[model samples]
Target: MTTIGDFMLGGHAACDDLFAQAENAAGDWPRAEGALGVFRDTLLEHIAMEEEVLFPAFEDESGAAQGGPSETMRAEHQQMRALLEQMADAARAHDERRYLGAADTLLMLMQQHNMKEESMMYPMIEAAAGTRADELIAQCRAIELRSAGTCTCSRHGAATA
Candidate 1:
C-alpha cells in the first residue's frame, strides 16, 4: 500500500532534483530560470496538496483544527511561499547571486518543514486516518497531476514521466 509518507517523500525528492537542476544551470540564465520555474511550480503543487487535502483530512481526523502541528506547518508554507516569490523575481532579473541566496534559505526551510511532516505529522495522520489515508493520498495525487500537468505519483497509481 502506498502511504502518505511515501507520496510526500517522492515529492520532496522530485523537488530537490528540480532545484539541483536549477543550481547546475548556474551561469546559463535561461536554463536556470526555466528550471526554477519548474521547481517553483512543482513545489507549489506539493504544498497545495498538503494544505488543501492532507492537512484538512489530518485536522479532521486528529481534531487539531483550532491549533496544532498542522497550523504550524501552514504558517511555514506561507513563509516558503514568500521566499519562492523572491526567488522567482531574482530569476526573472537574472540575478544569480540573489537567487542562490534565496534558494539556500528556502532549501533550509523546506528541509526542516519536510522533516516535521514526515516524522511527526505523517505518522499521526496514518494512525488517525487509517483506511481513509489511502483515499486522501489519492486526492493529493490528483492535485499534483492537475497542478504539474504531469504525473508525479507512480506509486499511487498515477503515470510517471
Candidate 2:
C-alpha cells in the first residue's frame, strides 16, 4: 500500500525527468517546443492532482483551511507556474539562454519545495490523515494524466485523459 506522500514524491520525480528532457532540448526549437510542452502539461497535471485532490482532502482531514503548509505549497506552485510560462515563451522564441535561465530558477525552487514536502509536510499529513491516507492516494491516482509518455510518476499503466 503506497502512501499518498510516496505517490506525490513519485510525481515530483516524473516532473523532474520531463524538465531535464526539456532542458536538454533547449536551443533546438523543434525539439524544445515538443519537449517543453510535454513537461509543462505533465507538471500541470501533477499540480492539479495536489490542488484538486490531495490538498483539499488534507485540509478536510486536518482542518487547516489557511496558514498551513499546503498554502505555502500552493504559493510555490504559483511561482513554478509563472516560471513555466517564462520557459514556454523562451522556447517559442528559440532563446536557449532565456530558457536555461528560467529552468535554473525553476529547478532550484522545485528542489527546495520538494524537500519541504517530503521531509516535513508529508509526514505531518500522514500522521494527521491516518487511515484516510489510502483514500487520498486513490484520488491522486485517479487524476488522468496528459499522455503515456508524460506519466512516469507511479509506473502504473498510462492514465490518458
Candidate 3:
C-alpha cells in the first residue's frame, strides 16, 4: 500500500546506497560494478515513475504552482542522469577516479533532491491533491509493481499492468 512518493523515495535511497558502496570500494572494479548496476536500474525506474505518473499527478493537483516541484525534479533528474552515464562509462573503462568523481556528484544531487521532495513537494501534494490522491497513487504503485513484473492493475488507460 505504498504511495508513489514512498516507493520512489525508497528507490532513490537504494540508488544512493549503491553509489556509496561503489565509492567505498576504493577502486575495486568488481565491487563497483555490482553497486553500479543497482544504481543504474534504480535511478532509471525512479525517473520513469515520476515522469510517467507522479509528476503528472502533482501537476494536476497543483496548477497554482504551475508544475513547480515537478519541473525542478525533472531538471535534477537530467543532472543525475548525466552523472550516471559518466559513472557507467568510467566503470566500463575501469577508471576509479572517473567513477568516484561521478559518484560524488550523484551523492550531492541525491541529497538535495531528496530534501526538496520530502519537505516541499510531498507536503504540497498532500495538501492540494484532493480526492484524486488515493486513486492516482494507486495507479502509480500499480505501474511500479507491473514494471517490476509483479502485480497488474490494468487501470491506467494504456497499461498500468
Candidate 2, superposed: residue stretches over 4 Å from native: 145-161
In the range 33-140, model 2's lDDT, one tens digit per residue, is 888887887788788888988788779888987998899999999999999999999988888899999999999999999899899888877887788888777776
Q: Give the Å shift of residue 54 in candidate 3.
A: 1.4
What ranges in model 1 sit over 4 Å off? 148-161
Clashing pairs in 1: none
| Best candidate, TM-score | 1
- lDDT by residue (1-161, candidate 3, tens digit) is 55545755676676677667767874788877766765566567667767777677777666754547688888998998999889878988988888888888888888988888877776666667666667767666666566566323122222432
**TM-score per model over all chains:** 0.89, 0.88, 0.78
Q: By the lDDT metric, which is better: model 1 or model 3?
A: 1
* Better candidate number, 2 or 3, judged by TM-score: 2
Query: Could you tell me the TM-score of candidate 1?
Result: 0.89
lDDT of 2: 0.83
Q: Ten consecutive residues with minimal summed lDDT in candidate 2?
A: 152-161
